[model samples]
Target: MFLLKVFFLLLQVVTVAVYSRADIPPPPEPEPIEIIELPLPPVASAVEGSCTSGTGCILQHAGLVQGGSFLPDGNHVIARVNYTGAPAAPDPASVYTGDQIILVKADGSSFSNGSPFKCITCGVPQDSSQGKTEALDYPQAFRDGRRILAGTNIIDCGEFDLVSDECTPESTFIHPIRWNTAVDGSGEGGSIRELRLHPDNLHIGFNSFTYDAGKLNQYAYTGRLALNSAPTTGLPMAPRYDLTNVNVLSNNDTRNIPLIVDRDQIRINTDAITVGEFRGFSGSGKEATYIGYPRESSNIDVFAVDLATGDVRRLTSHPEYCDPIDISADDEWMAIMDTRGSNRQMFMAGMRNVPPLTDIISTTATSSTRNNGQRRFFQPYLLDHYGDRDDYYGQQVNAAGDGSPGSINDPQWNGMADPRFSLDVTRLVYWQALVVSPACGGENPLPCPNSTEPGGRTERLMVAHFTSRQPVPVTDIEPLSDTISWGTPYEPGTVPSRELFISGGVYTLYGTANGSAQVTIVENGDAIETVAVTYESYSDDGLTFLDGTENITVRNPTVTLNEVDWYSDLTQRGQTNATKKTSPDGFHLSIDVNTNIFNANGTLSTTVNGTLYTQPANGT
Candidate 1:
């Protein structure tokens, strides 16, 4: 019975397995493998050679171009290309291409002239447009013409029509537009009227306006967008001017009427108004200008708006044409490009004198006198100005100050003129338009020196100090590569152990300096003795304050400002790196304390607890 049951089970298994195998049919011999094809990707390459319209040369890359210019700050150069071959305006549907202009720095790094290149970084392609071009007329220094404003926006080429419909039906295609520019690091962009960057609040003069009917007959105004003590305060301060019926007669007789608008003052209930004097009045306090062709017209005026008092001041009223004008903090000085004729010059005026404030101190039992420094006022000096020659306004020619007769290379014709000073009043720069003689008339005869003569500009950067004072070279400051290692003076060959990781001392318990320094103290609680181990060197001397104390304590904490003393004996000049050390209780100190303690004689001294310590004539 067991054998029969096993046989039945085996037969059933064999039947089921064979039925499944027969239906599979050996997996159909794996089928003859089939192969499929894929489409190829499009390849791209740069346009190899330059092509002009009607040449029938198709480039790997081509397009119509719109115009392009270097941004005012000269940061990034952009080249815009419109496929439309003509000078026609942008049709919203036209295709355009843009390329970023990049510059390689002295450090071997490349930066964009502006926009996507600054702050952020990127790799750029090399092309012929990367070099300088002579076709562009860029901004030159107001004085030193040779300085050749470093970062200039230059546009070299432009492309026209690319689309068949946009191009004239019978005409062919032209290339695209390309531009190059350099942006100065000084530019900061925001859609505001004023800028107050710390340490460099007035770096780029914007936010202020100038109006001049004539000297003193004119008034100047600046936007005090942020007033002291009150963030809620608005515009229009004292010394207001109403621009009603005001007119300026330029030497060239060109007249401009400004448009004015009034808006609600943010701080007060009244409305603050700004005259629509210029075309591009983006609230960002940046200056803009348009120079007259060949000669600049100095006819200019600015309306000042008071946010708080709804007042307007017409800053100036002068017959001469004015171009560049800059105002100072506290509304004290007004600097401008004054155009008289042969005397196209720069001028400054003192507006107001700052005052000193005093506060009384009366104790319960006694009274003492505590005087803070009084504010001193200075009279404004007239800077360089070049006026018109003969009857021609804005014609470059030599002029004199106070109507004195100054000789040009030939005073009768065009010569030394257009002097502009640096903001610090340290250097005077002037422009001399020269008519170069052509050698083509042989070295002998030129074309009678006509107005078409190639005119050149000159600028000079001078070191100007006060009268009887020699100009100092404050630039090109070199850094000190090596300084003496400092710490507690130690005995020769005695490897001193420090409770702190690196620095340790045993003589003084005066005080300690706080910072990222590691420190440790050890004492037997017996000696009240004091030991001062200081490493001294000659440095531009500064001041440190301290309070009286018997314990090894630090008293007054001293802060160092960059105010330099010309008399200091510190060998190195210009900006220098400085470091200091003081005690934990605020009494001990170490510094470049020996250099300029005396402002007159350049003497060397170190002050400790109100007592000046004189170092040997030549520091040890």
Candidate 2:
């Protein structure tokens, strides 16, 4: 049943309406609430483990576990391993054989190795330091129990047979399209990175770079491969780009790396492909907009192509580097990492005038033409800077004093990367780096000499709630305050009393707990409805609700309570306290809650049309 759920989630597709800035709705006004501080739960001890010489060496280093994902049940975690080294010995031979695919039981008591998925023609270099054999990077398991693996030179699909609980050799597809021998030394040899599986699971997309002679070329292609293909037959032919009217071949002069298609955008019957094209290299000497690269050559601009119709449209024309990171699930907004400024920042722009499938596929053109007089499609609003600290550079000290730390010794903020939206499009998560001082030996101010210095740097996972506008650190342990609630009142003028019909409004709550929690809605000291709430993990977070949790909503609930005494679990530790205010005209209900427990003494303004109620047990 769990496997079936995973399979359906992979195949699920959704579409959202694109809107212009003028058509976009304004964000909801913030709610009002008072917070009472409580002691945080005891921080749990670190999960302790040690790798003895040869037995546990693989788990010792930093980059060994490059990327991973858990199965639905979370009893197993599948990951791509790139062995670096251990503290005792820099590079251990037993572990550093090459890049390996591995599956470990969640508790670390057992593990299964899936390595030597050998490339048919690719040769293993005699030199051990050249890096792992084929150097596989990202490995992901599909819902059907198949694992898709990517490396510098090849991509492999490992088929898992449920009966034997093993990946059979014949079921694997080892494709060398990205690492052809003719291309390897011909200066045309390229590496495939950022491999993404399309929604259909049959098609895969990725960015590949090849340097031939004096010119450098980048291409993005989605190819068709069957799950049951014979391993001895070699991988399928390279995906054809020209067939889709994506001219990576003819326009070799310009760098035309395809922007990754948002997985959400690849649904049943969708033909549009989003990509980034370097405009200045057209050889036509057109005016360049992005200034990140040489002024003589512009940086990359985002464009969308219709595979079915061959129609192409420019989506953004920012003067600075505005690269598409990911599109929102609804396709209404696009999240981009804007590098126009000194520090990398996250921004969102309304997706406007997106061409339909019929319009995109039916149009015929040898090349995409710029939409003349079209307003720059991307009018990005700044979300947040990738790094919190503004005092120092990301690495090594320089004479310019850019790397000097301020008095606080705050974590040196590195640029943000891999910004992705939640499936619901209400939250965003990204990776952040901070250089911290090691306890023993390091620079006085820290993060100065360099991140390579004794202590090294710390990578932090961060998340932001679009509606809440607050950035929170993602901790290994679950949040103490797991649930938050907001409510609205109905028929304001119909009743003169402070009581309002909350039953007419939907009540939504967000949580970070792993299992189910009982949500009891109360009215006038009586429990009206007690519903069991189950929490699901987001993609950015692991199977556990350690990152940011999911949101659950109760619609049209049957309950009416005084605005002052609505929430039932206010006195419960780690539970949220909320208050609702109606506008003077009685048209809208403004609900607010003290969401963060760290700022317990926080107070809300009482001048609105609602009374502030305090719990006698825990005096405010």
Q: How do the residues 1-620 of candidate 2 rate in per-residue lDDT, one tens digit apiece?
A: 00000100001111111333475344333322121111111111112223323322232223233423333233344444433232233433233333455444432233233321121112222231122235454443343545444443232333443112344334444443332223122322234455543333343444444433222223343443333222222132332111111122112111121211222221122222223222111001111111111110112234433333233334343323344244443344344544333211111101111111111111111011110011011211222112111221111111122344421122243323334444444444433333233311242222232343122323322233355433232212121111111101111112111211122112322232322222222232321222222222211112222111111111112111111211111111122122222223221111111110011112211111132422111110
Please list the residue runs of candidate 2 whose C-alpha ends up more than 4 Å from where it truly belongs after superposition.
1-50, 53-81, 84-133, 138-145, 152-193, 208-213, 227-301, 309-324, 328-335, 338-417, 420-429, 433-620
Off by over 4 Å in 1: 1-299, 302-315, 327-335, 341-420, 435-620
Give the per-residue Cα lDDT of candidate 2 at 151.
43
Compose the digit string of candidate 1's lDDT tens values, residues 100-185. Answer: 22111111233332212221001111232232222212122211111111122212111311111222212321111111011221
Q: What TM-score does model 1 achieve against the real structure?
A: 0.22
* Candidate 1 positional error at 364, Å: 70
> Which 10-residue window in model 1 sums to the lowest lDDT?
356-365
Highest TM-score scorer: 2
For each candidate in turn, give its C-alpha RMSD to the true structure in angstroms: 36.4, 25.6
User: Which candidate number would show the highest lDDT if scored against the true structure?
Assistant: 2
